[model samples]
Target chain A: MMTDYRLTSLAKSLPDTVPFVGPETQERARSRLFDARLGANENVFGPSPTAVRAMAETQHWMYGDPESFELREALADHNGITPDMIVVGEGIDALLGYLVRIMVAPGDAVVTSDGAYPTFNYHVAGYGGVLHKVPYRYDDHEDAVALFKRAAKVDAKLVYLANPDNPMGTALSGAEIVEALEYLPDGTLLVLDEAYLECATQNIALPLPLDDPRVIRLRTFSKAYGLAGARVGYAMGAPGLIRAFEKVRNHFGMNRAAQAGALAALEDQTWLRSVQARIAASRNRIAEIARKNGLRTLPSHTNFVTIDCGSGPEFAKAVLNEIVARGVFIRMPFVAPQNRCIRISCGRPAQLDILTEVIPLALRAAELR
Target chain B: MMTDYRLTSLAKSLPDTVPFVGPETQERARSRLFDARLGANENVFGPSPTAVRAMAETQHWMYGDPESFELREALADHNGITPDMIVVGEGIDALLGYLVRIMVAPGDAVVTSDGAYPTFNYHVAGYGGVLHKVPYRYDDHEDAVALFKRAAKVDAKLVYLANPDNPMGTALSGAEIVEALEYLPDGTLLVLDEAYLECATQNIALPLPLDDPRVIRLRTFSKAYGLAGARVGYAMGAPGLIRAFEKVRNHFGMNRAAQAGALAALEDQTWLRSVQARIAASRNRIAEIARKNGLRTLPSHTNFVTIDCGSGPEFAKAVLNEIVARGVFIRMPFVAPQNRCIRISCGRPAQLDILTEVIPLALRAAELR
Candidate 1:
């Protein structure tokens, strides 16, 4: 029964589950900061020193430009698109929430892979949308075909795909994504999340039908440029969909410091390249460490590496717990099968050293148990 | 006629107007930045230097604590409440949007003063709430009693009141708000916006019923603490309503540097007091300027002063436009007859000097036109 202060029926129906548990919560609960902070896929290498300086120099008394005019212009130049095609926001998480709200109504169908970004699913649920989850193929990449088919079958309003995906650190190439877009249902808009796309640092033009109304790409300063805390992300699409976002978005939401930081970071591509190289090195190191412990790693195009624990979800959970107890913070996928592998983000050498030392120990403890 | 991607019917039905246009947009159009930035009511005194240092020192690579654990603990202590009773978000704007989303379903009623914060009314309309506007009484102050009566009559799910109000520089005391709470409908929740509360800086115990569920009070670092660009704000209320925010809020939405900056800013109460004093001085300067111009100044408890232009909104608009054209940025109330007044924020001495120079010129230009 609905009680005092009548909440929307959709709100009352939502469970009290947060999209992700912040690592700081764990730190507070344990009464100690993690010795090795590698979870949540943060770039421990940090933002460009130039960006930090620029952000720090901002007069915090002034509200940021609601239009994000300069940052969007910079990003448009960076991505070879017109400024009108880009809409910058607090983060991709927020943009996804806004997208879900605009597109989904009660019982509206949305499709995604079963083990895709939990936050996307969280937003869909929050908006009271019916979610259809397609499983991964051969325990690797998200099944694009199944996602397309499901959207068509259910007449889903939206479909979500993250290139260089999180958790599993697997991806669909841009060419593959472009081909799949043709198969999208006539009524469905595809949300192509590229938050991790810059991890490769290739600077190669990703094949995009930017003029297409059916697809929009999400990118962020969080990954390679390392401004996750600044919470700046953008969506690229046709002008119509871009303008539509202005209808529902928190227009005056940009952080003034973040706008400066993002602009500076974009200008400093040298730092991003270096961070990508470092993430690449760290990923290889993690794979090497896992291989030494008789574990196999899924090939990754992103910052993190996921190692198959060769047991079950139970074993992976025990190992993850042990690693946490050993002063390292790492996460794993939520569902079965993928849950058999623990996800570790790229870390600095000292933090990776902790991981280098702890995996085997965690494995032994889990085995003993 | 449903087209290629079905927007939520509500989204499709909404108008495309934004709540407020940023001053930056004005600057961009004019092809020059404003010489005096007084329109938004942001503190010209800026945040504590320690906060700038703390924010600048943040590792921008990591997502902020979704829990906002430390900030909440600090705020809880600061406010004499438990941490659970406070929920921090991107800003008071985002919190208000979230509150309206949770409380008002499509076609539900909401109540507010006729010329109150446009953003709140915008959010209510965004969520498809029917708004009942209670006009100002006693010539300037929002009629709190009228608002309560209208809300009860319309059975509004939500009611918004800005203490130390915006635009008109008027207020309803905490005790007055408490009395209003008693008259609220059974399911109505009052959104008590205290964005300018610290403008007083007197530390008088404003008779707030902080423990009451019927009222949720908003506080922000945007005004007195001079972190408008940082975008940090909080809601204080019953823990249940606080936790309900989790179901809809972007959990990791905070700027990491903003979180740090806020904590440091809070620790530096000396800086806050100093800024408040500056604001008071600026308020006096503005009043003096208005008096010199033969305009009446509304008694202000907030950082900005609303000056009666001694004419209708049309003359105020012409004066306001003349100010903008002269390279000073200022705003007026959007609704009538409140629009008869032009709102000016407390500025730095030089900025106020520009305002003093411009007001007479603006008045002369408006008269000539």
Candidate 2:
């Protein structure tokens, strides 16, 4: 039995658990380091030298401007949008928590693709919202139409779609999403998480109008920008919706060094391009290695490749455990069918080289099991 | 009429506002920079050289350990508690938001001193909690007895008390707080905000039992540690209450560089001592300057000194506005009596020199007004 201490009924009902355990926790439990640390999709190539310098030089004593003035100015300039349309926070995870709290009342319905980003669902649940999950399409892509249809059926106020979706590494075309957008009812908001859009060669990111109050788009510095530990993410929407964050969000969530790093990193498009090129090569190499191991790699527009283990969730999980046990960190999907695949991020050549050596051995171990 | 986007009943009921407008926002509005940055209680002496180096050398590519393993371990060791008794977050502001969310449901009762920290009240409002405010006693200090009595009477789920109280810059004795602890009801969790405790020369911080489920103490790197921009804060409490934070907190909310910098800052107590010495001398100089300007300075345990302008809130406002217009940044409290006092942070000698130059002129301007 737990001590309640008069915690809200919702909090009392929720389990004392976190959304995802970190690799460091796993490493501690295993008492070993991963030879190839690819899980969680952190960009191993790291941040731009300019950004690193910015972090060093940023005034660490003063609290960062809660307004995130300069960073927002740069982002607005780059996006050709006004600063009022942007609200930056610690990360997309933190923004999601804020958005969910502001939008979802107790028993309000929210829709998302089944086995999509679990963090969104985690937040939705924490706010006492009822969730409707639409299954992924046969190709393992998130079902855009189904999500919209479910939102309408449930009268959901919110829908979540992770572009170039996580785990599966599959994405819908921008046009495809625009078509589904017509089905969203009035007052429903689509939280489009484009965390990995930069890594994609194609700009599958929806060209949703900046003034469109129906959608909020999130971007992060953790992946292609290589500042995961800095925990910076921004949400862009209509001014009214973005401004709604002021009511509930932590005003000073932006870290000073992180903001400086993000500003410098934004200015270094050349470095971002280089990282994109490197990720493309790594993706190609990962696909090649998977082919050699007789595993089919899913077509991905994101930095990671999802290889079909050619069996079920258990087989893929065993393979994942084998890879992890051999000290190559990787993750797998949470649900059936897609769970038959294991996901690997765009590792550096050295880490990928280690991956190439161990994955086949892991497959052999999984087979033996 | 504004577009609602059908926000939650609670959110729709809430006024869209920020607790504090950042100085950068003011600078942008004025199209000018301040000569002195002494407001906001930030450590203008800046972070230690070792801390700056740590920020530079942090592993920016990786997500900070969600568990905050190294930082929490160091904090636990320093506090003579296990890591489980501590939970780190973006800042005390964020942890307060999360605590309010988890503890206070809609219509749940919470209590705090009327003119105490505004941010705590901000969070309580955002959560739709019914807040019962008790006015300060004649001493201008936060009335601990009044706060505890109000909490008991309201059957409050949460109570907030910031020692070395902000605005007034006065503090209570540890024994006095321990005496008030007797009035706290079983279901109420006392939220002890000790953000400025490290700056206090006296032992004003209560030696509350860490194992006591009735209270949680929050500390930050933003004040004496001079890492406000980093947004790193930790809450210490009974292991069970601390563990409860895992259910709702952003597990990876911490910035990588910030964590590294804080760890280094925690290790370098010599730097902390030097900063405290600087703050002490600065506080004394601020008091001396206020006396020379025909004002009285409150006895302060915090880094900032609140000067009684010997006038009402309007006169204090005039003085504050004149200082701001003259390119010197400082602030005044928002409530009466305390609002009669203008708060100035302990700036470096250069900044303090600017303050000394401006305060007399600002007072003259206030008199002219």
Candidate 3:
């Protein structure tokens, strides 16, 4: 007789599907590397040379300071907040998982935009939370008002809103989000993910007080700082909520070299400015390429552009598949109406040249299919 | 009115205590750094130069291959097992958290030895698992038979055992552990933590079949491999049990450079052997110092030694405090019997010289107090 492992009902109930299949997995399946990698919105511009040097020079034989005191202090100073208000972790993805575990018990309600970041939904499901998704607006922006209203209806303990939203590259202004807060239920805590805040064209920092218990904001080094491989991200919130992470977090989880890298990266504002400029230029180049292919592009407040394939979800998926087949990697939103578009991350001029060369061909092939 | 951010009942119930207060925290509290850093069982000889170079040379821009395919494949080849049977994470701490989350639900029973690794207990409590702890044997080894018997009696879903145990620096042979397995109940799973295996003088790798569903063994790059700061560890188990980690793990949580560093470290068998020799020499030196100071040192099979203070827990703690004040960092066990001894990690020659100078003074101060 076989031994029964006896996994928890929640674990057993979880589907085998992951939120996003990595480009590396796809490359392995196809047995070829992508010539122009743009699918995941990674900053190809890379981290500051100073940051790279710091990581290389770190004493990696020692465990990272479990409290991540130095990095948290640096982040606090950079954000104009006290160190107690910040909690650093492996990444925004891991932070989301921790937050979901803390807030959502079995059968608890959590709210998110239907086609927003799927990783948040994955965490909710992993924790046995019942997710209630509100659809994106017709303009392809996350409907914050609708999300808050639904949270009220569902009595959700948590509501997720990504400013400068992913998948569609659209965003709501800070004032607009603040106005939407009125609709949020009294007990629901809003998770405002600003992973791409540094990459946005406009200053999108919310004007809410730092001690506001109604919301917690997440930030990452993976975007404009170009240290995604370092796996460093942080949550800024009320001191009480931030202190709660201490109860269950893997205290020594931070990589020493990554912490050093992030600290150095945060100090290099010149590098950040240059990367932001490059991203702006690349976004326009991608839009130009989409226009030449007779496709419309969504106005972006992020590092990626969402191109309307001018048809249904099938057509958009075909376009993505064709691009992947041609050694250019990209992704599309999963849910419909938004699924009629494909998302393309900003890249260097050389990578953009490949995108320029491949778009029309991919479109033709996708249309034929 | 203040906003009510509702945390789950489990989250609210969790205590503020952490698994281990990092040595850095101590240094900060003292407003001075330790002259000899021997507290945490971190390999002071450091990771291989080749590993360091590999990390420095890695691409920090790209997010690590979320599947960690190359590293996993390398690990599989090294262990003489298929890649599917392993799951890599940020560290053993995170992996343990994920494992406990999968097998344990609120009020589920888990078993571990009293005065075993607190991190495992922390994970159990984090998930609301009811932990049943059996006392350590008088010989200072983890009482494996007692643990299994308790697991069976409590109908535990999981039982944790660390060979060449921490805080005590004692060991039971692989054969002894295999023999003790007979006491384990049919449905109970064993978590065999081998974090210090590479540091052990004996070949303690369990001889059981690799596909045994009853056991999952965790290994780390943090000890003899000296990549504790890199935060890399892997779990080996039956394929079905390993596959379940996918349902909840942070797939993209690895630092890219850490993966590169660990792969390079694994390939450098010469560096590992050299570190092993150093650890052995350091252990003998530590025992010699303890003997000179009129204290009894436990026979160690690990990178650290536990020295009996020739008195009670209070005396041992006073000795630890004096050592810290004297700028030679060291620790002691938290629970009774074991708490009568102080633990010290193997250090470099210069560091050991500092320890030699500090130990006598610390003992005198402790006795005087």
Candidate 4:
């Protein structure tokens, strides 16, 4: 007899596709490791040595504090808010998934920039929520006002805005975001992903009240703090909204060492400042490389720089493929005008040296193609 | 105007309460740390030194492989299955949540023992699944046959069974489980949680076909391997069922160091064997302590022992409170008949000495109350 493992309609409806394939997957497929792992926007400067030692010294036999009490307390202090205002999770990805689960019912509308974070869209779609996308602004920043207007039109439950946005690597100032918040509908919650905020050159933090119910800001240790492998990120919002996470979150999901690592990373401001300097220097190096190759680089507010390939998506795709073939891992945006650009993460000087050697040759190969 | 976050009806319905309160929270409330950390059934023997070193040496800057390819391959080899048949997740709790989300739509039927893992029940309720509970057998073993029968009656999409059970610390043999499987309905999936299987003395491993679509077996490094803080667990099932996890799982969720730690933990079977020996000895010591205190202990197959308090839930609760007041952290079952017993985890020799010193005093206090 045939056994029926009855998957829910929503589960069956979701496509069996991941939002982003890891570079390691490509390495296995190609049977060779990349010389420069500059694709995933990982901080090449690494986490604080103090944080690494902290993780190493943690007691691994016991379960992490399910409440993540100590880590949340540190995050609150770092952000100048009370512990009740924060909810920590595996990362921004998992946090986004939880937020979507809490707010989006099947057939509910959610709004985001057309080419912003695909992971957010993946979460929205996973929950059977309808997505209404607004195009980016002419300057390549997320058009938050347009997104808010669309949210109002669709009566969307959530509107996602990634300040210092991914893929395009351009950002709107904090003042610009505050001005745009006026257009958001009263019922809509803004999921402001500040994942790259620490690396940005100007308007470093969003100036919103800690108790603002209309917005939930996300921050991560993955980029500037350089603890991506630790899988630590947190959401700062109204205490009531933060408390609601207790209803659905995996209480013991956190890795204990990660909590210790993040707390130490947060406390070590010197390491953060050093990493920021390195990121800035590397961003300039990438822009210099792009200029030498006769390609224009977008003004990046993130650890990665997006370069205009002087052609369409197909040419940029060829360039990316050629770069990968030459053993320097890099990626490109997935949609329309954004797809016309190839994004390169800021890397260590040695990794950037490899990128410097490969890009011109890759461009030449793309031109021939 | 009142701001509305527009949480889904389901979200609003869920109680803002966590399933298990961490010992740290209690410590905060009491303003003192427990002298002996025996609650939560954590393996006090700790993880392999190799596993701890592996995690400490891992690159903390890069994201863990989204596929968790290396660890999955290691797990597959260890389990005598192909990689496609496995899915690694944050922990069993998170995996159960994902399974419930996949199988149970709103109002769909699910089955479990009435006082089984509260986290599973929490997931079912969070997903809006209607649960049909079966009672344990008189000997305190999970009633698998009765659960399958109830699943058939309710047309449950899923049924959860934790072999080598929690709270009661009792288990059915693998042969008995196989015998009971015949009663399971064709459409219902069985979630066989074998978290404490490594510590059990008899019927140590489940005897089931790897390709069995009717069952998904969950294994964790948190207990015997002693890596609870790492939050690593794997599910083994038919390839199709395992692949379905890709549709909704946070692909980038695994902590890199955790993946390394679990992999090393899996390789060190010598460390695992030593831990199992320690657990067995600790269990015997705990049982002896209860017997000396004029209390009977349940036959335990897990890392914890359940002691009959010789009264009702109230007396057991008072005993537990008194024990806590004396600076020993321990827990008890949450339901009737079972609640008449207090649960104590297998602790180190030093920790058990403290338990020996404290139990009589605690019992006397409870008797006076």
Candidate 4: list runs displaced more than 4 Å.
A1-3, B1-3
Q: On residues A1-369, what C-alpha lDDT tens digit does candidate 2 reach at each position? A: 237667788988888787788898999999887788898899988899999999988999998999899999999999999999999988899999999999998899999988889889889999899999999998899988889888999999999999989978888999999999888877788999999989887989787777688889999999999999999999998999998988888888899889999999999999999999999999999999999999899898888999999998889999999999999888885687678889998898898889989988999999999
**Taking the tens digit of each residue's C-alpha lDDT, what string does model 4 give over B110-142?**
999978999999999999999998988988889
Question: What lDDT score goes with residue A141 in model 3?
Answer: 89
Tens digits of per-residue lDDT for model 1 on B206-278? 4765767778889999999999999999999887888788888998999989999999999999998888889
Docking class of 4: medium
Q: Output the chain A TM-score of model 1.
A: 0.97
State the weakest 10-residue window (summed lDDT) of model 4 chain B: B1-10
- Please give the range of 10 consecutive residues that has the lowest summed lDDT in model 2 chain A: A1-10
Question: What TM-score is obtained by chain A of candidate 4?
Answer: 0.98
Candidate 2: tens digits of C-alpha lDDT, residues B1-369: 137688988898888778888888898899988888888999988888999999898889999988889999999999999999999999999999889988988889999887788889898999889999887778888888888888989899999998878877889988899998888877888899999999897988787667678889999999999999999899999888888887788888898888888999999999999999999999999999999998999999899999988878899899999989889888875586568888999988888888889999999998998
DockQ of predictions, in order shown? 0.67, 0.74, 0.76, 0.76
Q: In candidate 3, what are the lDDT values of residues B121-196, reduced to their tens digit?
A: 9999999999999999978889999999999999999999998788788888999999999999998999999999
Where in model 3 is the C-alpha error above 4 Å? Answer: A1-3, B1-3
Screening candidate 1 with a backbone cut-off below 3 angstroms (N, C-alpha, C), the clashing residue pairs are A90-A231
TM-score of each: 0.98, 0.98, 0.99, 0.99
> What pairs collide in candidate 2?
none
Candidate 1: which stretches are off by over 4 Å? A1-3, A201-206, B1-3, B201-206
State in Å the error of residue A276, model 3: 0.5
iRMSD per prediction, in order: 2.4, 1.8, 1.6, 1.7
Per-candidate TM-score, chain A: 0.97, 0.98, 0.98, 0.98
